[model samples]
Each structure stands twice: as C-alpha cells, then as structure tokens.
Target: MPINLPNNQARDDVLAGRPALWLNPNLKQDGIWDTKLPVRPSRVSEAESNWMLIASLLEKCFPELKATGGKIESALIEVSPMREALGYSSSEFGRIFVKADNDLPVAGSIQARGGVYEVFMYAKALAESQGIISSEKEVDRLVSEEANALFSKHTIAVGSTGNLSLSVGIAARALGFQAVVHICSEAKDWKVDRLTRLGVKVVRHNADYSGAIDLARAQAEADINTYFIDNERSQTLFFGYSAAANELASQLSKAHITVDDNHPLFVYLPCGIGGAPGGASYGLKAIFGNAAHTFFVEPVQSPSALVHMMSGSSEQVSVYDAGMNNKTEADAIAVPRMSEFVAEVMKPLLSGVFTVVDDDLFRWLWIAQTQQSIRLEPSATAGFAGPKFIVNSPQGHAYLEQHGLREKIANATHVVWTTGGAFVPEEQFTKFMERGASLVKDS
Candidate 1:
C-alpha cells in the first residue's frame, strides 16, 4: 500500500489504483486568504442570503430548528481524552475542538448545511415564481397547502453517496417537492431506506459517485422542471457551506478563543468533491486571514482534491489520472475527481493536504469512541489523522516554519470537522465499531 510516486510519475501510479499523499507546490502566499471578504461575495455574501432562507425554511418546516429559534448549528466540544490518546500534547498542540457536524440535527451531517440550502434554493424559486409566497412577511407560510401544491409540480434531484441525499431529500420532502436521490452503490443501505421511508425517490446506480451524478444530471436536463443539485459544480452549495464560518466565528468569540497572529486556528476538513471543505476553508480564511491554517484530509484511494490542486490547472483532473481506482471504506469521500471550480477557489487557500488509509480510519474511529465517546462513521474519522499527519510530515514542519507559526503552535486551536453519522442505525454503527475495534487490536 506504500505509494512512492515522484513528480510526473504520480499521474501514472494514480491511474493504476495506487494511493498518494500529494502536496501542492504551486501554492501562492497571496494576501487573498487574508481578505475580510471577497469583492462580489458570491461565495460568502450569497451564503448569508441563503442562511436567511434556511432560517425561514426551518421555522416553517423542521420543528427541531424551530424549537432552537430557527437556528441550525452544532456543538464544538473539547475531546481532551482523544487528543491525548492521539499523542498530541495540550501544551504543544493547544486545544483540540471537534466541530460536531456529525451530530447536527435533521440530516445529521455537514451536508445539512449545503444540501438543505440547495433544496431551499430551488423550493424558494419555485414557490415564488408560482406566487405561493409573496414576500418575506409570508415566509412562515412555506409549509402551507398552496406552497406544497406548487412544489409538487417540480422535483429536486441530487446524486450523493449518502449524507447529502438525506439532507436534500428531507428538505425537499418537507416543502412538498418530489425528492429524487440518485445514490451510488457504495452508499449504505440504511441511508437509502431512510430516504425511502421519508417518501423520497431513491434511485440506485451500480457505478461510483461520479457516475450517479452524471446520470442524475442527464435525467434532470431532459426535464425542465427538475433541478439537479450538482455536487461537483454548484455555487449555491458552496455558499451554503461557507456560512459555517460565521457560526464558528461566533462560537469561538463566545468561548473567548483568540484567532490572531499569536494564536492561529487550524481546521482539518475531510474532502469529497471538495465543496464542503473548500467552502469552509475559504470562509475561515476570510474571517481569520492568515491566522487560519486550513488542511484537507482525504482517503488514500481518493485524494482527488489534493491531486487537482497539486496539478495547478484550470482543467478537470481525477485521482485516476495517477492510477487510483478510488476505492475506500469512506464511501462519502470516495469521489474519483475533485470539483474544478472548488479546486480553483481553494488553490491559494488550503495550507496543505494529506491522505489517510482505511486502516487508520478504522483505528481512529475506535479510539475516538472508546476514549472520547465520539462515535463517527468511517468517513467522518478521516479528519482525526490530520493533526498527526501535519505534526509528523516534513511538508507540514516546513509549512509551520514558513508561516512563522512554529512558536505559535502552543496557542493554536485545531478543529477537526466531523462530517456525518448522527442518524446512523444502531446495527450499522455497531458493525462499524466492531470492524474498527478489530483493526485496532490487529494493529
């Protein structure tokens, strides 16, 4: 399983089904990451716009967020036990907080951010166009029969491994839109069944995530009334994901955590098609400037984003370009290719990227639950290795020195964004736990 691809040979090895840990050498230290806000705000500002719609939708549709005053946010907890178990010193690595998006309400994943937002976007447009709701004052009427009737005429379609489909389907069904989730074969059966139980149409494909998306896109294009939530190239999804930064900023401020020159903030996000992590990184950089050091974690078999960014191209690229067949237990992040748009957006922003094998994912999953009571799906455990990877790698040490962050390591706060698994069936979770535990014992 050892990957030793050097330079141009990486493309060949990746195509042959080998895994790699690729670092971007064309990284630019431009002051863009430090900018308070991008000029157009298409990514950040529109995200705020969508956030308001999310609030409205939640207020009228989901009773849970309504109970919480229409706010959609998750916990940022300190897992000192897990941190210590990972051999990260509190004195040297500062505090470690797990942004528990895995336990998020409703769909229970990071996809709850963008996935639901995209659904709401399509719903809002349809409802407004049909005169179902006239103004902001009438937003609460989104759950009305009139709105539902208008929505039933159209459909919201998306291709997902699991979590994103749950969010999209849940949101779409809530507003009376016909939810169609085209899922890859690797997605969990429980997820598909759950969506089906909610009256969402579950279309199964034997191909991978990309194949499912391509099929869904084709189907949606054939019908004008169908809106495809394109995971690979959706600006709406990107904006929705970016809104997390504002929420995190408020949480950090409330906890009296300083994110500045002397106290850096490091975020490790697990990457799939790159929208979630890419948008999150962009927003963090916008908020904290250079003080925010963002890294993306990928499964070794599908380090698509890393490969794309390393190539430094505007054209599309796939992990298969280097011989990777894109197979991993982390189904949610098993995408073969990265989003070109997201890659371009994240090019100058990401501090580094690394890969963790499936064995490590299982080991970390067991460790997290047994030691910290933080149970995560296999894919969610991908970020757990981020801190260790950076601390041990030559590239990471050099990055710290280059950024003048060597001395500031003690004050740095590392946040591993847990992406999914709150609603995983007990049976399925137990199986994952058992597999992880067995792997840990063997290792």
Candidate 2:
C-alpha cells in the first residue's frame, strides 16, 4: 500500500521546509490503551521507584543535587510576562506556563529526564547482576571503591547531536563508568568540550545524526563491555521520560490548576527524534485521558516526527524523503528521522504537530530572556509559538470545534516545555542573545 498524506497546502508546505501545522487524523479521544503500546503506564511508577533508589548515589556524585535532595526535577513557572509579550491575553489563550527543564539539575535539558534515568537504570542492573546492591535497600554503596572498579570495566555509549550526549555522558561518568559519545557534525563545540572535560571519549562523525547512531550501535555490538543507549528503540528511555508526567501532575495539583473536561490542558513539547515528546504525550494522555491535548513542535526544516507521522507509513521515513534539507540552527533537534518506536506508540495518543521557522525560534528566545529571565536554546524556544498556532490557525480552530473545545478555550492550561540551555557557555549564550535581539528589532 502506498502512503497517502493529505492533499493540501499544509502537506506541500511541510515538503518545502516551510512552517506549517499537521493535526493527527487518527487521534483518539478514547480507546487509546486498546492498542499494544510500546511502553506501559505501569512502567512510569517503576521508573519513579528507580529514581528514589538511586537518589542517594546521585547526591553523593553531584554536590549540586544536595539542594534538591538528589531529586532531578525542574520547576513549572507561570509565564505572565512572556505570554503578554507574545501578544496573547489570558482570555484568549488561557494560562501559559513554562516547564523549565532548562534549569534542571543534571543535563540542563529535557534529555535529563530520559538520558539520566536510562543511565541510572543501566547502572542499577549492572550492580544487581554483580551482587553489589539489592533492590530492597538504597544505592549508597554505588560509589564504593570496589563498586567503582566493577563499573570501570563497562562503557556507556550513545549517539547524539548534543544534549542527550551531555545527559548520558555526565550521568555515566558520575557513576564511575567509562562514557563514550558519538556526535554528528551538527553538534555544537560547547557540548563536545563539556563531554571532554568530564573524561568522556568523544567520537566526531562528519555525517548526520542517523549516521552517528548507526556507527555507535555497530561499535557497541562488536564490544562486549559496551552498552549502547539506543535512542531509536529504547523502552527504558521511553519510560524514563514518561515518569515526568507524575511530577507534572503533582505540580499542577499544587498550583490549583484543573484539567478536567471543562478546563482542557494543552502541552507543547519541543521534539528531536521524538522519544522525549512521544513519551511525554503518552504519559499525559494516560493521566489526563481526554482532557489533555499534547502537540510536538519541530523546526520547519527538520520536521522529522511530523513528516513521518503524516505519511502513515510503517517503515521509518526521513525528512529528506519529503524534500527537506534536515538543516536548522536548533542543532539539538536537527534529526533527519524520528524513532520508529516512538511513532508507533504515539500514533493514537498524539494530538498534533506544528513546525516553526528558525527566525521565530530566535525571536522567542529573546522574549523568554528579556520578559521572563528564562534562558533557553534555540530548540527550547520552539514551543513558544505553539499556543499562537493553535489559537489562530484555521486547522486549530477546526480541531477545537471538532472536539467541542471552542468554549473551553478560556479555561485551558497551556504548557510550553523548555528543553535546554542552563549549561550554555557565556560566550555562546551571548551570541544567541545578540542574534535574537537583532531578529526582535527587525521584526
């Protein structure tokens, strides 16, 4: 069977690498769990339990975790100033909040949610197999000299454009494991420098993200001591990210926000290969059911998830197949293709996807800093345009009417998940700010 996308301008725009919105025609309001999903909701609680078990070891490894008592979590900030700067009134777009993962403790990005958790999961499994620790007790002895010797024999490896490498490398090294990161040409110099400073082996590839991942997987398969963190098909990574929804639920309760039918919730996440956003959307759907609407935001030139999902193909599809160049300044999310595991899991759960131009990302980055004192990378700022796209576009309005949510718009809750930037060097961040400022002035 041939894959048939919608014969419309939106499809044409996506193929041309222009900004557009593509709603999931197969999005379901019920029976989401009827399909065999890749990661189950029960695994989310398991991941939470795993985090608690390793909390002590994390605190022992990083002094920064002492403030949060070894909890790797971020704040949910209500963004009144930034919302206003974006030209949206509360009545028009409801309440807007920034899930400030950029300020998260470990990797300073959303990758901290999955990348760190997956590394911890691996460390725990390795220890259990060696009889170094038991599930009944805390992992206090993980930093012992004997345990470190055991970890030294193994290597944790992954392929990334940038942020995931930082998250995995930092966590693996902190746990006394040898860490190797295979990064693509698009990866930023600052990320490579950070990994090198952490004593992580950095393998530079002159190819794209998929090529780097291919090389990493092949090398890991050949080495008995190397454990590859497969971004494209890791159930551990998916569940690790899904666990974040529990934290979001608790934060929403504390903030006195409602997400019932009368008060819909809309979450906009910046997507790369789609593991983080796909896991997040799946978790949100499990918690809020029909009340939560989750969308993935991507760069126009690298709409990997959007293009693949829109095609409705069982085989993996790359943005290049749709005539996109797979080029963008949002290097962190410059993925040519999305994870097939994520696509299958999100086919029913995801509400929609939208694309943004690079210029708009910079403009939003400037607004986030000047208006709210929130620092973020270009990729992190992708979600800032989500609310506007949903409220103003024809497809967005049609979606609301189709779902009987037009009247519920004023009572909705919008969350823009900010992905990364806390560890950005002063000089690099200064350059980002300068470019953003120039874009803002010209606009």
Candidate 3:
C-alpha cells in the first residue's frame, strides 16, 4: 500500500496501472525514512560536493555563465595506463585519470561540469524572476569582473543532444551569451560544425532529444532576452550538475575512499539529459545517506529514460527514429526526457542499467585501446563498459548472484565511470565508420 508520492492509495495506485516503481517498500535500513525525505542540509558541506559551491552559485547567482575554464576542481585521474586499463582497484583511480588540463578550454565533455553551472544559474534565475533591475546589475558586474561577457547580454538558450549542447554553446560564448542549439536532426555535421564554430545558433529539430526540447521551448516562448537553459528540464541543471558530484566526492576524499551503508556504491550513469547521473545521484545521496547505488543508461535506440520508467507518465522519452532516433553511437549518453529529477530520484534510490552492447561497447573501446593507450570512444567506453556489461550478462550474472555482485565481479574492484573524453581525436575511428562509408542513409 505504500507506492509513494504522498500516497493517496499511492496516487490511485499510480493512475490505476500500478508498478509505481518496483511497488515501493525496501529502502529502510535504519536511517533517513521520515516518510522518506529529500533531506540533505545538516552541518552541510558535502565537500561542497559539486564544487566551488557550484562555482559560487554561478558567480553569485547566474551572471551569464561565461567561462574560459575559470572553475573546475580537477577532472582527469584514471591515473597511469588508464588506471591499469580499468582494473580500477581504487586509489580512486589516481584522481580519475586527470590530464594536464590539455586546454581546449570549455571542452572535455563532463559537459563542463553541469554545462557551465546551468548557464550561469539559469540566467540569474531568469533575471530575478523577470524584474530585471538593470539586467541584475549587468549580471552582477559581469560576475564580479571575471570579464569576457563577450559584448554582454548574449541571450542564453540551449538544447543539446551532445555534450551538454556543446558545453552550453561554449558557456554561452564565454558568458557574453547568445547560444541557440536545439538539436535532433541526428546531429553531427561534426557537432553541428562545432556549434557553428562556437558562434552557436544551430537549430535542427526533427524531434528526438524530445524534439530538440520542443524547439527549445518554442525558442523560449519567442524570446524576451531568451534564457532557456534546460539540460533536460532544469533544476537549474541539478544546480549545475552538483559539481560533478562535487568532483566525485572530492576525488573520493583524495583516495582515502570509504564507502559506508553496508559498503554501498554503484554508478553506471549514461542517461540522456539526466545531467551526468542526476547530479551524481544528488551528490551521492548527499553523501551516502542511504548508501546509494544509482544506475541510468539508455541507448538501445534511445529508450528514453527507459520509456519513462515503464510509463509513469509526464509523457516524453520515446524515440521514433528521426533517423533511427539519433542512432546511438552513444553521443555522450543520449538524453531525451530528463528532470523528473531522474524519474523521481531513480525510483527508490537507483537500480536501472541497460546497454545494447555495441559489440560490448566496441569491445570496451578496443580494451581501452590495447590496455590503456586510452582511445575511448564508443561513447567514451559507455560509463566504463556499463558495470562491465552488467557483470557479464545472463541477466548480468543473475543480478550479480542476487545482489552480492560476485566478490565485486571477482575483485575487479568495481568503478567503471569513464564517461567520455578525448573528444573527436578520431572518435574511436569514427564510431564504426560512416563518412568513410559515405555519410549513411538508407533512411
């Protein structure tokens, strides 16, 4: 009788169809259950999890999300030989395969950690809920003078199906704004000619990626200084991707790594518009509150948040082949329906993983290019080969022997999160050749 959602007979047994998410129930291990709260602010500081208190809450509340890599606390650490070729025996995989920052600036897809703080805090909360006040002190004096407001008021709007809409159209042209991407004509005229060479304004829309977010919400309701920064239906893009789950819990506490709640942990995120695992499962359940085990991957021709979790309905997340509905080469975990906050927090805190084994994600991208040469494409090793293809299938080894995960899959030390990088340096030999086969189209 529990089902959830303020249970009026579990909201009429979820509109009379039932399956109100695994028929609710489990989640009571001893803590956090006050009718199952959304709580998470005691004594605070989940190491300011998604980092720099979300880049100082988009430079003091959305001053036109401009950037030339001004904030991001270290992101490259699969240290050394791709951490022994994804054997990943902890040591937080040496600060998660960090590079020398190899300067493409707003490039290396983790969608610039929440697409440049949800387009500078949702364009300063829609300019203080549309009153404006000298455009919110010229967006707080162009974000306390970090400058680069590229002749300012650039007018923000994003609709992405790839790398957070080309990393919020290069952070709205490094903060002066003026982006307009709205994808889904099966994008990739080389990422729409690299978002019109970062001047942005690429609008395609045959519909997929929710019909390029319904033409970017009808061009943000016919523009009033456009600010529709929806990376799948923003909670300000999970307050800017909870800063990559606060940089994976501050690099797993600088590799001291201690997972509690009966040693709980599991993350195989790769969902479209589900902003990098719904802000890394709300900052790892606000730091392991009920332990945590989030999974959300979809690519069997865009299952669309697994058909809106077997159909609970707020309708949106189906793929009717606008060109085989952006045929999953796994453009950084293709998204369509997002912001039901990952279907109400991955329904009872997580467990949904699917990967249509593109020959086991291009054989784990040529076994990370012959063990740690690190080529990684095939959607950057599908979140590190989606928990080693669900612990080697047969219903993922019988749900890992009814949930023990067979000694962490015989001590592989489970942590497969290589969620894409090395953008287009031969995108894993052109994600199985197309231009080499004359830009596909039997249609």
Top lDDT model: 2
What does candidate 3 score on TM? 0.31
Q: Please list the residue runs of candidate 2 whose C-alpha ends up more than 4 Å from where it truly belongs after superposition.
A: 1-4
Output the lDDT of residue 320, model 2. Answer: 84
Taking the tens digit of each residue's C-alpha lDDT, what string does model 1 give over 129-228? 8787788667666778888888888889999899999999999998889989999988989999999999999999998888999999999999998899
lDDT of each: 0.80, 0.89, 0.54
Task: Give the per-residue lDDT digits (tens) of candidate 3, residues 162-192.
Answer: 6677778876676567788788765656777
Q: Which candidate number has the best TM-score?
A: 2
What TM-score does candidate 1 reach? Answer: 0.93
Off by over 4 Å in 3: 1-50, 53-59, 62-113, 118-141, 144-176, 185-202, 207-242, 247-262, 268-270, 273-275, 278-294, 303-394, 398-443
Residue-by-residue lDDT tens digits, candidate 2, 340-426: 999988898898899999998888888999988999999998998888878898878988998898988888899999989999998
RMSD of every candidate to native, in Å, equals: 3.2, 1.4, 21.5
Worst 10 residues of 3 by lDDT: 17-26
Please identify which of the two predictions, 2 or 3, would achieve the higher lDDT against the true structure.
2
TM-scores, all candidates, are: 0.93, 0.98, 0.31
